[model samples]
Target: MSCKVIDTHSQLAYVVRMIHCVCNNINTAKVDAAAARGAESAACVQRACGTKFNCGQCREDINHRLAAWRALNPMLEAAE
Candidate 1:
């Protein structure tokens, strides 16, 4: 039997902190924190982080992050 090798670079890329909002300098950690604080929308997340949309390009990524957060917290979704 042969052993399998993992692509460490790809794994590292996946674990790296991403800048979800380049304009506001907001990263995934900030988005996650906002989601934990009950921010249901991108605007709410930005507001919670003391920022706002400038170019609107980050909306999709922010929404994606919010969706992931919601998926992980089903009880919070039920409460909302």
Candidate 2:
């Protein structure tokens, strides 16, 4: 017999979706997708996500997400 074990905790961490923009219901996945699609600024990310800043509190978080995305995608940053 063979047994397999799954690390749900670690797997859940990767699958977890964080709400970065409460005003527009934007999540980290959306932000990353926008970044992957050439969104260099928060405004670009908002536009790509089909929404705009309302309260504006999420701007900084969006920027952070963009920065993290850029870090992961160094080639995109180098090309820019």
* Highest-scoring model, TM-score: 2
Off by over 4 Å in 1: 1-16
Q: Write the per-residue lDDT of candidate 1 for residues 18-51, one digit (tens) a residue.
A: 9999999999889888988889889998999998
Model 1 poorest 10 in a row by lDDT: 7-16
Which parts of model 2 are misplaced by more than 4 Å? 1-16
Please give each candidate's TM-score: 0.73, 0.74
Q: What is the lDDT of residue 25 in candidate 2?
A: 93
lDDT of candidate 2?
0.85
Estimate, for each residue in 1-80, the C-alpha lDDT of model 2 and write its tens digit.
99998766744533568999999999989988998889988899899988989999999988988887787779977886
